[model samples]
Target: MLNLFKKKEKFILPVSGDCIPMEKVNDPVFSQKMMGDGFAIIPSDKTIYSPFSGEVSVLFPTKHAIGIKSDAGVEVLIHVGIDTVSLKGEGFESFVQQGDKIAQGDKLIDVDFDLIKQKGFDPVVVIIFTNNSIKIEEKLHHGEHHEKLSISIK
Candidate 1:
């Protein structure tokens, strides 16, 4: 019952990649609305790697979303694109399954940008924490498409 009073913890990025911010959250429409919570956007034609070291908490059957738990007890959720979940695994592929252990840089999923575009969805990737009580520290914006971005515990 005391869990409600637990102090929020901040989580750092698990991988070093470009961070893209979604226009909105929990909205099925692809309209570029304002984003509520900040999200890290990773843009790459290659494989999407695990940002933090943790066990896979959830893997959407559509291969559009994944959830991971960090060793530090932080929970993270990654969604590939807007409204892409409805594709039902068309242009997306999962390399790991639920309950799998993953480390930073570990390959998690492979996304086909071309196919995703063909399906009429933008391949804007988002990395977010499922738990939001934690405070973030030293968050840095290393510029779009920059490969040197780093995230650290606050």
Candidate 2:
């Protein structure tokens, strides 16, 4: 009966761009949902925002990816560009450190997609739920606004 009280959370798009099905991504790891089922956005802007209020769980030294764990125990991985690790922090600047508390819309990282592209990488911002158990209650592609996706943690 207590299930009714479960906190409902909404995820805003980390960047402003096109939302495509995970299957459509070029990388197999993300396309197969190997890390976890989530979504991807081809960012038109350089700044990446926090999708939800959470603690920064893991921030890669290379600054290619970040993991944020929501209070509800949802772990979200935000990876910028495919095969970006090889860049070794180049063209990427992180605004938040690991373990930092972040709110929705907080600036997390600034990525230079042009540099990534020049380095022969696809700058597709991939957001994945590392924890497979969390169910994505809904995916609302509200055109060009703060509200884009929603996830309910049970």
Candidate that would win on lDDT: 2
Task: Return the lDDT, model 2, position 112.
Answer: 94
> Mind giving the per-residue lDDT tens digits that candidate 2 earns over 1-154?
0021255555677788877667778999999998887777778899998877889999999999999987667678999999999999999999999999999889999999999999899998888878744444444252333334445444
The runs of at least 3 residues in candidate 1 whose Cα sits more than 4 Å from the true structure, single-residue gaps closed, are 1-17, 22-36, 134-143, 148-154
Error of 1 at 88 (Å): 0.5
TM for candidate 1 is: 0.71
Number of colliding residue pairs in each model: 8, 0
Residue 83, candidate 1: C-alpha displacement in angstroms: 0.5
Clashing pairs in 1: 8-133, 8-134, 9-134, 14-51, 14-52, 15-51, 19-41, 20-41
Cα lDDT of all candidates, in order? 0.62, 0.80
lDDT of 1 by residue, 1-154 (tens): 0021232322334344565444433353322323223455556554777765779999999988888887777676777877887788988878899999877678898888778888888666776645643232324343455443333323
Task: Rate residue 11 of model 1 by lDDT.
Answer: 37
Per-candidate TM-score against the hidden true structure: 0.71, 0.85
